[model samples]
Target: MACIQVVIWLFVVQCSAVCFANYVLKEEPEYKHTLLKRILMEENFESLESKINNLTQRVEALEKENALLKHAPVAFLAELTKSVTSQNQIILFDSVKLNLGNAYFNVHGNFIAPVSGLYQFSVTACAATNHYIVLELIVNARVVGKVLTGDTGYNECSSNSFLVQLSTGDDVYVQHKTAGDYLLANPAAGFPTFSGVLLNVI
Candidate 1:
């Protein structure tokens, strides 16, 4: 009887050990599967972050390019071609012989700044009778500068230039401030001209 009890006890111990070993083996693959899935998720998250960073850099570059294009200089040069001395009140240069920078000078003879900037404006007027050639560089209907010819008589030409900071939509043109018909007629010599250029954009 004592021998039989000992054998039964040994058999029970062997069965318990086998069951525990099978459970560990089955659970190991599941644990490994969970760990592998977690690793893949982390890798995907890192890839998404890299893509976002690249896109952010591209956006910044485009913004800088747009800013540079906006601040680019705009300029124009126009000349009065007709030689006949004519009388006028407020003269608008209708014929645009030379125009640059999107041709801001219009048929109304007004230069409208596309962007705010420091502008240099100049005018050359020829006196048919050779006297003080009176012309005003008007900005927004107000006289800011005037041209006065020093030498008076036949075939005399004088020029005056001014520097001004202009905002967008500021109108710039040439007008006669002196009383009576102002002589601006000289077509052959090509002396009468009005011009403006953007020096720096603010």
Candidate 2:
């Protein structure tokens, strides 16, 4: 009877060990599969995030470039070197202070519009001790505006500004109304200056 009990106990112990090993085997494979899935998902997510960041940066760069290109870049600041005597003579702003995009404001003192747009023009004149003259801002030889400077014995100064629409290839220059009257020259060269800038592209 004792021998029979020993055999039965051995069989029960063996079956218990087999059951524990089967449980361990089943749980380990499930854990490994879950871990592998998580790792793959994390890698994929990181790759996608990197691509998204790159795309976002490119989009921002393109937006900045497009904003700059919205308006045609053109600007000029010129000053006359000497006094003009003739009535319809073009006051050459010989100094190249700032000429952007090209020589739009050339030695002939004409701000030729390269694009149809609104532009702001300015002219400052200094009065001499014995001269009086009217300077007109003429577009294509038509008197659009004028600024008068006369000797007041106080080193008088006169300046005029205008905002006008100019088409492509339109000519803009200053002209004296009378031939005999003269515009006073400034030794500093900054007092008698004519400048124009495009306000906005049309």
TM-scores of the candidates in the order shown: 0.58, 0.61
- lDDT measured at residue 73 in model 2 versus the true structure, 0 to 100: 78
Quote the lDDT for 53 in model 2: 100
Q: lDDT tens digits, residues 1-202, model 2?
A: 9999999999999999989867776879986687678877878788878999999999988876665477557787777767766675777777767777563565577878887778898888766777777788989988888888787465566899999998988899876656436776764747587778877666
lDDT of 1 by residue, 57-141 (tens): 9998887666646775566766776542344455565556656666455567788877777899998876655444577888888
Count of backbone collisions in candidate 2: 0
Stretches of candidate 2 exceeding 4 Å from the true structure: 1-68, 187-189
Model 1, global lDDT: 0.72
The per-candidate count of clashes, in order, stands at 3, 0
